[model samples]
Target: MTKEQLCEYRELQKEIKRLQARIEKLKDKNEGYVADVVKGSSIEFPYTQHPILIEGFDAEKKQASISRFKELLSKRVEKSMNRSIEIAEFICNIESVKIRTIFEYRYYDLMTWQQIAYKIGVTDESYPRRIHDKFFEDSPN
Candidate 1:
């Protein structure tokens, strides 16, 4: 084969490898989401024992404050979930299924742009940027 043909073959192989890696990453993300759904809420970090020699704060008051903090956190989580569902529905309405999935996985699932590009079978990192531009182009500013 000519040098040009060999170079093209190598490039094609690289692209295929990149696409395979991206698919694996996306599959892993989907598995994680499925596991989370099956498992319900994840375990929280255990509270550590407070130092015996502390400042002048009351122990009861501290415990009360911690409980209140946890309640606030739970509310925030609920609010965020609701907002995410709203955004996902909006994307579903406007974009193609593939682009919508990429948007949801990247922003809602908190995956990196590279990860999203991989899932969509794109070898280039710039694919995520292009997807974002396309999404926004049809969206109201």
Candidate 2:
């Protein structure tokens, strides 16, 4: 795989993390809405709590919002999984063990060059990075 293509894996990982945070925020907001709904139902006049909401409309909007969020999360997770698999397959297909290890450590395991160097028994972090750079240099861009 080209360096640019392989680099996309890291970007995708970040996007998934961002999406997770957003989903968590949405869940917290949804919980607040649920609590409000429950509290309003217990009162003799529920409209006092939500003066602007029409009967049943607020609940329907909440449900639709939840369903849409779930669908978006599902599709993003699936895309991330597929991208991970593609990256794995590309790394696996490489002929050189050292090159493959570099790819796995850097992309799959999300290790720093220093950590990867230590894992491969090298003293300098530059060793692994140089190897990675050289490999990309030699390969077709």
Q: Pick the candidate with the highest lDDT.
A: 2
C-alpha lDDT (0 to 100) for residue 82 of candidate 2: 89
Distance from true location, Cα of 102 in model 1, Å: 1.8
Error of 1 at 132 (Å): 1.4
- Misplaced by over 4 Å in model 2 are 31-57
Backbone clash pairs for candidate 2 read none
Candidate 2 similarity to native, TM-score: 0.68
The ten-residue window of minimal lDDT in model 1 covers 30-39
lDDT of 1 by residue, 13-54 (tens): 445455455544542332212111122332465644332432
**Worst lDDT window (10 residues) for model 2?**
31-40
